[model samples]
Target chain A: MARFGMVIDTKKCVGCQDCVIACKTENKVPEGHDRDWIVTESHGKFPDILMEIRTERCNHCSNTPCVSCCPTGASHIHDVGGVVLVNHDLCIGCKACVESCPYDARFIHPDGYADKCTFCIHRVEKGLKPACVEVCPTYCMHFGDLDDPNSEVSKLLQSRKYHVNLPEAGTQPNIFYLI
Target chain B: MHEIFTTRNNPYVDPIMAMWEWQIPVYLFLGGMVAGMMIIAGYFLFSGRHKESNCACFSIPFTSLILLSLGMFALFLDLAHKPYVWRLYTTFQLKSPMSWGAWILILVYPALIANILIRPSQWMINRVPKLSEIAGKIQQHHILIRNIGILNMLFGLMLGAYTGVLLSTLGSRPLWNTSLLWVLFLVSGLSAAAAYVHLVAKNKAESELLAKADNGFLVVELFVFVMMFLGLLSSAKPHIEAANLLLNGAYAPIFWVFVIGMGIVIPLIIQLLAVNHKVKHTPIAPIMVIVGGLILRFVIVSAGQYSHWFNAHFH
Candidate 1:
């Protein structure tokens, strides 16, 4: 019943995209489609400009519109850590989940079914970190159970100032960025 | 006074890309039109108009059944996993609008089929002699026929509203996230159906009556649309921006020129004149309404796609 979550440090992230490449290879995401990517944001004038580089993927929301909108229950929350996953066989490729995702996380796979980051549930179940988290060269990404107060993610969230993307969206996104 | 620049190059989700193409709009249009046909046919049947040789109910329901099947085919084509399309009927998710839509669509068949049984076609009766007996038996049972009419109208209303409610359920798309969308689509479908019935119904009195009804539906549809625009405009920044897509943004020209002008205003004027007996009823007006309904679907769906929830971090 653990609620798994990810915490990324915005200041430390260099946007190297090693995590993106690692995820594509680990998940075997089709060529031209990506399960994870990076975003670089900058603001302010000339000499006082500021930039924050962040890697992004599915937020694995607690209140997921993707699962709620899925007609066939093809998209679901995992029993173990509440990771969002898609049942490829049950999917009708309707794209209802794709359109409903506020994160713009879900996409229709080239082969048909809606696909997106699963938090590497397969790996998470095997007692390992998600491929993206494991391959972060800067050691900027952290993953652990959000429900467990003793977990690394919980500790970091408690001790650091952080923000979740699109808080107004009300998805209750699990991904947190330490500002 | 801070400036920010954040971007991603994902071709699918970024840059206001819509995963759905022409198939979705076409399906909605056909679905909405069929919905309109069924309700009109249902009302006529309830009024016991089938006894008259020139009544539209006897023919329109039959035609709507086929068109509903066509619309389902369009829906099937839009599915990414076509082979697994049957999964929709496997287990229904109560919270899902798509699930509700799937069940509503399936139930529509029985309503349409029972309406057909109220008066079986000659060829059908000829092919299966028992069909004549069955039709006759069903016709004599006034209660069952009326119930069938009620079912047709019920399903028709569900089908019509579901088309827009489906999109409205997607809160991510601000343009479609409105309480008024279902009403707008339902009225538009009704108007389109009335226009079509007006165009083809041989019953002169009924056709003229429907022509007037179409005008009323068109005005109500215009009102619903304005309410939807005002609803979006009065909301958050993203929603206001979403409304602008059809108001002043890239989607404006087609929405105003085609959907509002040619689709509603022009057709309503023509139908008004025709109903008043000022001008002979031309096929042009009805056709415009039908085409306008189709374009309305296209515009709402396409414009809604361009309106996504703003990603604060992604810009």
Candidate 2:
């Protein structure tokens, strides 16, 4: 099966939080609850310093701990595209999967359901990009199937040395960052 | 002291803000205990000689089921929206321990009810003269159900440990991430169950039963307590720092008074004195131990969450 992944070019990214607002509006995500955030890395001493910002969301791991630990089989990767999605109907809101997630990507919604980025599965079904991807002014986030050699994401991975978050976790996150 | 609580200047965050409160912890503690106790209760009901069986085997399941249901309700009440809470079951994720816990409860409830129903019926047949003959015959058919009780007990233990594992899985939460978390939880669960049993029976445990269950439970709890603290001491910087916040920070008083003094020291001393005096068993010792166990749960849940590591990025 083809695996969908994204390569985020942090060098080209501005950390404008457009992705955050765009995702919220598209998904109707609750206020005070964020599905994505910009992590600002600051360096240097005294007056001279530099700040680098990276936007983070679910990395859509291949070996997801959340799916492994879910007792009721509520957390699973979509067979068609390997997107992680929660089966709200089967979930008991025990928050085990939330606790197990390494990225802190998921949260308990006001309705007590676990919610996170689904890689915009609904939009993907319609052959459209995720809301964040559609809204990125810089076009820093690139999404495509990794299986096809000619795919954009596949091409980026072939050409650039990128970093994946928390590599030690061995989740094999599909999201690659062009650091 | 009041200034620390009122002002945002203190880097610490009250546990109430971070997650559940005293009531919820109490509820969790009770729910786990009931789960463990029911399993133990079910085990004894089937294996041991009927006449030799003590009140404990029967009472544990009966009381535990009642408390388990009650604790489940208390948890719901703690939530902001009790009515829509059913949505939680549907919003499942394997990565979320809360989701795992929800399913555990779902499985445990039916097992608990089955054990509760089976034991009494068996007891009635054994005790009531008129029904004794048919009851004995029917009891033979209950082998499958009895085996289910054994399975349930083992499942309950897993559920109980999952509670601690759930918290420990949060790598950023230093205090909870210790390897000792599972042991601490198991010991606490057993102790809490023993304590509830002690309290319910008015601490009137027979010497043999106390020797097997209560005395052993308290001693094991003490061992776990020592190991937990020692483990915290030996851990890396983040965990050690988190431990210090409990021993020396704003939560020290509660830790010392309720958790250590009342919960462990006093109860240990009483149990020791009883053992030394050759009393064989004493209600006072177990009663104190029970109270101590409950207080320990309250303190650990509260103290562990009393402070937060100030965000390094923010500072």
Candidate 3:
């Protein structure tokens, strides 16, 4: 009955990539695969440069293209809390989901199935924050129930200036970046 | 030639959805071959020219098998996991064009092959009246094959159009979302199919039949091109931008040099000149027309994909 979400304050993010390392280690993710990571978008050259470092994950979209594209129903919204999860057993690894995804979030794993961040459902079920959220020394990452009015995530949603990546995609991402 | 494209940023990411590097060419080749064979088969069936029809009978089956088989294989290659691709057939959705295509290939391919083999078996059985039972069986097969041929033709029509429909279905991708997309695909498919059959006929034996096929194909191809160009012009902003890319942007050289210049204008001019002069020396024009048609498919498939992806990313 809960809708879990994350809020990362970009101003506080130092682009240290601690969240990326924590995710990789916790998930046992292979090298060259970052479940959630930062991209530094730099405008202007040399002395006049302005860099916007964006941290991103699967977005746990409300209407996911990846889910629509998965022919075998390997990828689905988890029943418990609506987290996007890929069942490796059911996956045919056709890569249709990969192609249809506009955000470039999902990837074909070394095991030949679509893989993305699961919002650390295993940890959340155990009543702990995701590894990425725990390791963020800047306290940039915040995770709580979006539906619960008194929850931190809900309070931030009510008060903060935030943005979601590729909102035009109409996925209504759960991850909100407070710029 | 290589220098021009070297410094060019690929812009294609790990999941190459739209750069359309090789998939477009493969699609063009397959669609052209299928359409070419279909047109030839239809012509032979309708013409009732039994004796000379042997050329078409042999070539149609052979070409159909090669094109469709190769096409399906190319499609598998396009997949990230080629091994489990059979699941596509088992787990199918009627609403999705891709699922429809998978079903189309599954039903039509074996049917086409069986039909092609029947002609030779019938010929063999006729030589020996002692094999009357065998001949009867062959006759039954011939009937079945004929029925299958009908199915293949229907599938070919869908196969021709599905390429466009598949791309157009992505409504978010503005460049490909057009009502005209399906029509363009069908037209291109038919044109390409005609050329392929004509070429095959020429290779088998130099005959007036080949010339006739060439002439019919040229006329149909020209008509389709006109419709496709008009559709391109009348489409929404995304398709219009896609058209502009073909006419003026990065793909302009390929479009102008290969598709428009060689594929359309040159072939049209050749066909016209040959017709006006009543010259038997103008067989080269028909061949050129076929080549042009193939090139046109290549250009459109490639350009349509590139523009569609480019627009999506930028948006």
Candidate 4:
């Protein structure tokens, strides 16, 4: 029942990639594979340009196409927190979920199964935040149960104007970016 | 209030999914060809074209079993956890195309076996003496044979459509998101199967008929490809760019040269010529069709990976 989510404050982000590094280390995401990454876009003419930087990872949408396409139920929503997780043991490495992810979030781990940002469910279960959130130098990343009105992530959404990536995708992503 | 920037450019360039290699496409191509072959064999049985039916049936069961095994082997190679492959059959997920495909594939073998049982081959009889008695008993009941044929056709159609559906269901890849993909794949499979049958068929009339049928499938496949392109072109910006990847981007040469030219157009023209008696019916055209069909799977699978939602939004 707890819809866990993240609210990323792009305005406060410096794009230091601390979150990316933290995620990689915390998850032991294998060499050359990323659980999280930085995305930056430069806008306007060079003289008056503005650069927007944000970290990216799995959106963990409510309607996850990855789960729907996975043959063996390898990819499924965690019963407790609505978190999208992959059961590596059951994975056929078909890459169906990898391709179905609109965010380009999921990757085939070198060890050979579809993998992505787990929202650090292990840490969450232990009352700890995701590694990226905990490591954000700018405090731009917020994580908590969005369904809980008292949760920081919920409060952040209530106060800030935010957008989700690829709205046309219709995944209803849980990751919200506060502009 | 300031205007927020919305530009289609991501400064970072990361590789997308590369786990699916040549094995995946090879499996898809083989699975599709087998499905098409079964469908053709079933049709022959239903129409009481016993000679043609026997020709297709004699080969289909064994060919399907071998090819399906090879395809499954390719799939097994792609699996990260080979030991866990059996978990796929534990339960069926209605929403999952893969689950459907797995179950459908399981059903395919039974239908194919039934087709063979209805008309046991001399080789099969020699190998398994009991098969002769079973074939005799089954042959006495015409309705049972017709029912098996229908089952084969249904399973074949599902298998053929499942190949494209497997890719098309991936919402992230714009190139594979078209509704027309399944149709294109089905037609291409039929064309490939027909061509294969034409090559192996001993009867002159059956081979000629299959050649003609393949031409029709080719023409429909061409149309489906066009519709797929135009459908993507008319969609959102990302979809249009995805279409461009095949139309005029990095994949242009392969798409046009290999998939379109070698796969559809050339094969279509050669078949037309052969059917019209302008050229002798050599194995050249049929071989091209089969090659083209294989290449089609490669192009679609690889190119679909190349066409990404993220890439479309940025550069």
Each prediction's DockQ? Answer: 0.65, 0.13, 0.25, 0.46
Per-model CA lDDT versus the true structure: 0.89, 0.67, 0.64, 0.83
Give the best candidate by lDDT: 1
The local lDDT score (0 to 100) that residue B203 gets in candidate 2 is 28
Candidate 3, residues A49-151: lDDT per residue as tens digits?
A: 6655656777887887667656666778898678989988677665556555556566667777778898899999999999999999999889988889999
B1-315 in candidate 3: lDDT tens per residue? Answer: 011011111124332335344655576557646854664574454343323545565557766777777876676666655677767766776445666766766766665655455454455447754455643464565445456556556666777777667666654444455666666656556655555554555444534445444555556555655665567668655557766777678878987787667665666565555545565434465566556656666665556545543212112
lDDT (Cα, tens digit) per residue for candidate 2, span B19-74: 44566577767766775576566666556422244556655666776787888787
Model 3 docking category: acceptable
Ranking by lDDT: 1, 4, 2, 3
Q: In model 3, state the lDDT of residue A102.
A: 54
Q: Write the per-residue lDDT of candidate 1 for residues A89-165, one digit (tens) a residue.
A: 99999988888988788778889999999899899889999999999989999999999999999999999999998
Query: Which one wins by lDDT: 3 or 4?
Result: 4
Instruction: Report RMSD (Å) for each prediction in the order shown.
Output: 1.6, 6.2, 5.8, 3.4
Error of 1 at B310 (Å): 1.6
Q: How many residue pairs clash in each candidate at the backbone level?
A: 0, 26, 4, 0
**What DockQ does candidate 4 have relative to the true complex?**
0.46
Maximum-TM-score candidate: 1
Backbone clash pairs for candidate 4 read: none
Using DockQ as the measure, which candidate wins?
Answer: 1
